[model samples]
Target: MVEVAWPVIHATQVEQVIAVFLSREHPHALRITPSQGDKGLDVIVEQADSTYHNFQVKYFATNLNSSQKRQIKKSLASAISLHNDKDSDFDLSLWILTMPWNPTTQQLGWFRQIQTDLACPFSCEWRGLDYVNGLASKYPQVVDYHLGNDKSRLEQRIKDLENFQRLRALAGMPSADSTLVPQDLLTPLAEVVQAINRDDPHYQFSVEAGPYAPPAVSRPGLIASTTIGETQVGPFVTFHVYARYRHATDDRPLPLTIHLNEAALTEMDRAAWQDAIRFGSPVTLAPGSFTLDIDLPGGLGVTNGEGTLRLFASDLQAPQPGPVRWVIVGPASWSVIAEIEVQNGPATRGVAGGIEFEGIDSTGIMTTRTRATPNPNGTFNLNVTISLAPEQELIGLPVAQALQILRFIDAYKPGNRLAFGPRWEPIVRDSAQLIQIDAGSATALISFLTDLNLVSNECGAPASVPNWRELTRQEFLGVRNAARVLAGSTARLEVHESYIAELAKSDIEMLPKGEPVAVTMPTQFELKVAEQKFVLPFTEISFSRITIESSDQTSPDPDRGFIVFRPMEGCEITQSMPYGAEGDDSLE
Candidate 1:
């Protein structure tokens, strides 16, 4: 058996081996050397579609340290910069190749974070020892050429494992004992769990909702109040820190330090405070004892309030003694008020505005309105109001439920066009029209064209008259043109600003209008040529009586203007007219 250390392999040799393997795997791919200052890309494979797959080879004996990791990050950043500068027309996939060892879990997490921060257009992958081993297993010749030996030992090791498994089965014994379990598999799981549960700072601290004052009714004084409390696990020194609160609508920070007092730190062990400064690292104290709470006088505004508290702790003692713990507290709250209103309703006895629909049991409805009002706008207005409870005032509205409600409301919007098929229906032309749209928290009021003295079969009116009476022929023609234009068009509807002001739930005060409502009425004339039947697009279609006689006979007088059909290009007029008349004038 021959042994070859992976760390001894040169970077250039690794690149060549990878190139060979890639070429074998993808016969159509073309390999090319990158030019000088080619970012982090050492070897590039170009495809027929102009897509580029880049590879960077690094051979190392041991795991990367913090500095080495930073170096790799910097190199990747430079490569990203170069890629952006070139603005290449093709998509790119970058592969970072390292041999002998894979990156640690922490290093992989860091790499993922960096990838997200950069937001590069290209895809990235980390090809470590496992990837190299995979390639070697597939192409033994390539591995032997580079490493001076085949994968005989690796093959033997696999056989040994197979033999061990068979022996264990024959003996009727368990396949794995504690001693047989590889340290690599167990160590990662143990370390990750410990790191998440203990070392992670987020798990060490927590913030909770506290006491609050009721919201005022006045416009300027309508301040929702709340308290913010933080709890830290284990014993640590406490310090009074400056606090600030930001309003949802404004960027200016409001001073919350006035509310901070010693009483807020009552949860912290008074006994621990005496020895906290004297104690060194790993000092033990009673669990669930360290806490700090502060009351917010003004609470969050009618919208939202985000508060941040900063503090410092001195724990380093022996070699370098200074403040070692730096804590930043960000506690947020919102004063959310959700209201929904409907415009008009039928009058009923004992109902103030309209009627109230309440849930029957104690487990009442979480959403939906119980009260409805009849507005003067000839519509029913249903109102549902929601305010943040004292406990939830600090956190504002629950994110999960709020998203669900918003999604439901979004799904309730009107679709584009209402189809009435080919049949014409009677539309109330002179009545007061009410357009009610459910737009989440906002009320939409839409105005449409009305009172047009258009031609209609609903009112028992003739299709066409000898003399235009109440409605002129010109007016009828104009209405037809307007209807055609309005068929597929869209219109915007206005939302009442007062509804938004009252709710304070959303900043959007308008529901954007949807596609125009089209009304199609039947025309007077229908034409049939051969097998195809055509409905005239125009509504003002009319027909008149006409007389046609032979050349030897005298023709009778024409009664009225005759309607003619003109065939445009691409239209096939298969049948000939009775008199052999052609071009421009075809009677239907």
Candidate 2:
């Protein structure tokens, strides 16, 4: 075999190439166009004497087999009539069958037999592979016009791939070269993200998945795949994070850690706060970008939140890759409550594309930071934190999602310190089914319960569940001036700003924290708030001996919760103090 630069070509395109070749040969070739009636010849050439020559072009990528030889004889048989229009029958001048494939000895013999059997008056010829090759050499420009050479084809393919990627990207679709992800691998990734949620200190976490488009895409690649292990070209994903972190005035990447294996959610995992995707370790993160990877069954992915992350490197294979990404979206909030977003939806617009949770608190200034890493399961881990102002309410979120988030924070676990305000307080207590709300206004609590459909206008709890038990009017008000007072502990009462210009709880008295109070007591001492009768349970008898305390310098006793005392006769102070004393046990 001699080496030659002959360009490889397609059989279907052979006629087109031949058309150019023949048209070039006879500048005035009378091409039989579709607009005209079907002709026995693909094209015709005029001789000087006005006689015509016929050329029938056929493309056969394979050798002339028996069936093809028979078709050829049939095709040639039609030439018995006039070879030119208006020419008498049997007046065939010349007929040529042009085909791309060379004929074998048997095929040539068959062709000779067909000619002998037809016994036509004019000559018969075959413009097979050898003739076509000689024609190509003689008219190289025509070949180039029809089919480009090797280098041109490669360059064109590159351009095609780039153009396709550009088009898809402009349309917000995944890149043509995008690495699709494995669906089963996504389970672990989703689990890892959940682990980030369980382990990270983000007030709100979410994921913004990049497109998981398969190899089923434009020009250079197949638009749809069926063969096994031929998918997951790329997986582009993003994880979100949000927290309240006070960064120092310097340029430094955030700190984070990620664990891939699914195991117990303990230690910082908050033995009580873990899920199926729980667990992680610590790692450092550069401000704007970071690295991510894990030993996944397939390949890798990319994306970030409130910031950016780039994707490259890794494997992506598994039948067909679904658009699944586990992202730790950072929840956002401007007020007391953060929005807890629902997760996981359709592939096109997963996360439902409803609301984005990027953990940004745009209250006054923007202080969003991020941290991300990868798991061994080809999933990712990301965390974020923002700057928060002092005095703002902690944990303002939807009740249900709030319940879920609360279960994972440091405050919910032992051997941990929960960050609040400027200090990290040691969280010595924990509970799963209970939450403490210290809103002094019963009306506010009632409104909240109403919003959640957990309570009625009359403060009646829903259903027979003891957790939602009913509350009495007086008890609905946070225990003011009450304490966890032991027998020796001193007690104090609080006066709140009047709920109305002239209304107060009558028969006000000392009570235990969360203790139900009586609405009326005939013998209770009363300090009138514009004449709304008020009473204290233990104060009527000690009215004269009771102390009226303020922020005075005389003394400050912290343990002031035991019994309640009332004001002196004719001495009225309408202030409803959740505290009238500065004590550690002050009713708050």
Candidate 3:
């Protein structure tokens, strides 16, 4: 029996386990991820008939309760809304509420009541701990990777490692592993042991199962899969096998036998394994579920970035649901350090790394976090969060920026502020609010809404605000420009200090003087504004050449002077709004 605590498992792990199960059972039908902001639908299994079986997985450590019931309802409502949308991708036929733990008898009643109260247009079902355990009995690899215990395959691997360590310590081998050797076993016994370890190939590895398609989820009918396992093979996994043979040892390292429970090994994989016997680039001989790509820093063997093995379990979409079974059989020389598993699919918001830009304005906080993950396919997954503090951005958000924020305002929620670093680790924390709305917060929104020319400034009866779709193209253009400004992080000198008032009509602009020595004093300069041109008198003028670049600043007292000139306002630069047939699709 798999004696593992169900509730303690992370919600993400629970989701992956179910996904793996569905991927096996429904292989072709298991859609990767259904929705963008995934509110209702978590796992979508699209059958050949074009009908969808949607599962909303929840990691409720405890029995079903009122709060969970409410959550379930909300999720159902959201999923229904998606289905109602004409543009939606799938035809919803069944709704599944799945969790890691079994519910109590009373909890089951609550679940049934929820299903009945919703009066769902589609069939509804529940899957709990028993469902997962049933799958685990057959797919033990899943448990060995995620919910492992003392009696697990993972445990046996650990025991093997401990035994190896005991023997190594008994032999009193050096803490470091080495490969350089010219003599045979005639060297010291300890030296012989070290030499054997170098050639004997002590290595570990890992495997990650993903879709052959770039994103590995969402789209249906792609019908291909890939299994990537990495470990050292040539040196341990490279071409330096000659070094291993240098010291007297067994004939050669035994070739590893990789197994995929479902798909047959592709001819490419077979050829790759054949090449492995010759000790060519072993990177193609991916076999195990979890194989270390390289030795630890300063550990031993041909340790570098180039050492990695990749294998494939490619298969077309099968007609019916089945489990994904991947296995590895290696020689005694190559030990199973661990058969690790569990990972967030492409849709997971939690990222391996991310970037952030934040600033404080009027006691209100604003943050923009962005993460882009490139997929094997040309397309990529981009996650961006533009959050505002005091959430409603009351006092003043740039009018243009507020318009953009208002577009996706529904995604915002009220919460304390927190920041994450590149490693996706928390770097800052504060009572700073994520968002909220009230007279205080809405004050700015209200004033800005008035700018829309929707309501009258004259205080009177309350009226309905204009819809967001009602916004003009120019308004959207402003938002687009603002987004570019934030994303580009570019700056230019657009303004200058003031001078005389009599020159108010003068068209003034500054330009860098390329070569000072090329010209002397009394040089005339022409300035143009729009179609009109203006010339300023060179009275009391001085030139500063070094001001243009650092290399010119040869002296401590670099040239410091100004050539003052009057400037006139320029004509507005305008482009037609992208709203009609002639609209630009570049931004899209």
Model 2 ranges off by over 4 Å: 1-10, 34-37, 84-91, 151-588
Error of 1 at 244 (Å): 67
What is the alpha-carbon lDDT of model 3 when measured against the actual structure?
0.40
lDDT of 3 by residue, 1-588 (tens): 444476777877766666655554554434435345774777787777988888787777576677777887898888777777788876789888877677778876876776677666688787877876676665554455445544534564565566556545555645377533324223343343343333122122222222231223322212122222343221122111111111111112323333332244577866545433322212253333223323221133222223224422222222113211111112221222111111111221212222122222222343433334446674434443444565533324433345333422432333322222222222222211233421123434434344432211111222233333445654433333322322332212122332221111111123332323111122222222222222322212222221222222232333333333222233122222223343121212
Q: Model 1: per-residue lDDT, tens digit, 1-588?
A: 222366667866765666655554544344444464656665566656766776655555477877766766776776677677756543566555445467889867987888888776677777777776676666565566455673455664565456555545444544574234434335434443333222111111112222432221212211222333343432222211111111111112233222223443445434334323322111222323333343322222222223332221221112212211111111221111121122222222221334433221111112222334557896654444322222222122322333333333333333311111111332222321121343443111000112111222222222221112334444434434433333432212121111100111121122112322111112322322222222323222211211111122222433222212322223321111122222222112
Best by lDDT: 3
**Native-to-model Cα distance after best TM-score fit, residue 525 in candidate 2, in Å:** 99
Worst 10 residues of 2 by lDDT: 347-356
**Could you tell me the TM-score of candidate 2?**
0.24
| Every candidate's lDDT | 0.36, 0.37, 0.40
Per-residue lDDT over 1-588 for candidate 2, one digit per residue giving the tens place of the 0 to 100 score: 111123355654676667656765675565565355434556677787776777877776566667777767766666564443365422347788887666778877877888888776677788776777777766554455446533244564465556545444445635585644455345445554453443212122444544463222122111111112213553444333332121110111233223322243235533312211232211222223333332211111122221211121111112112211111212231122211222222111111111112222322222232223345675444333334333123223333332323222212222222221211322112211121221112344333323332221112322111122344344333222221221223333333321111111221134322332222111223322211223333321112222322222222334321233333333333222222332222122
If both were scored by lDDT, which would come out higher, candidate 1 or candidate 3? Answer: 3
Please rank every candidate by lDDT, starting with the best.
3, 2, 1
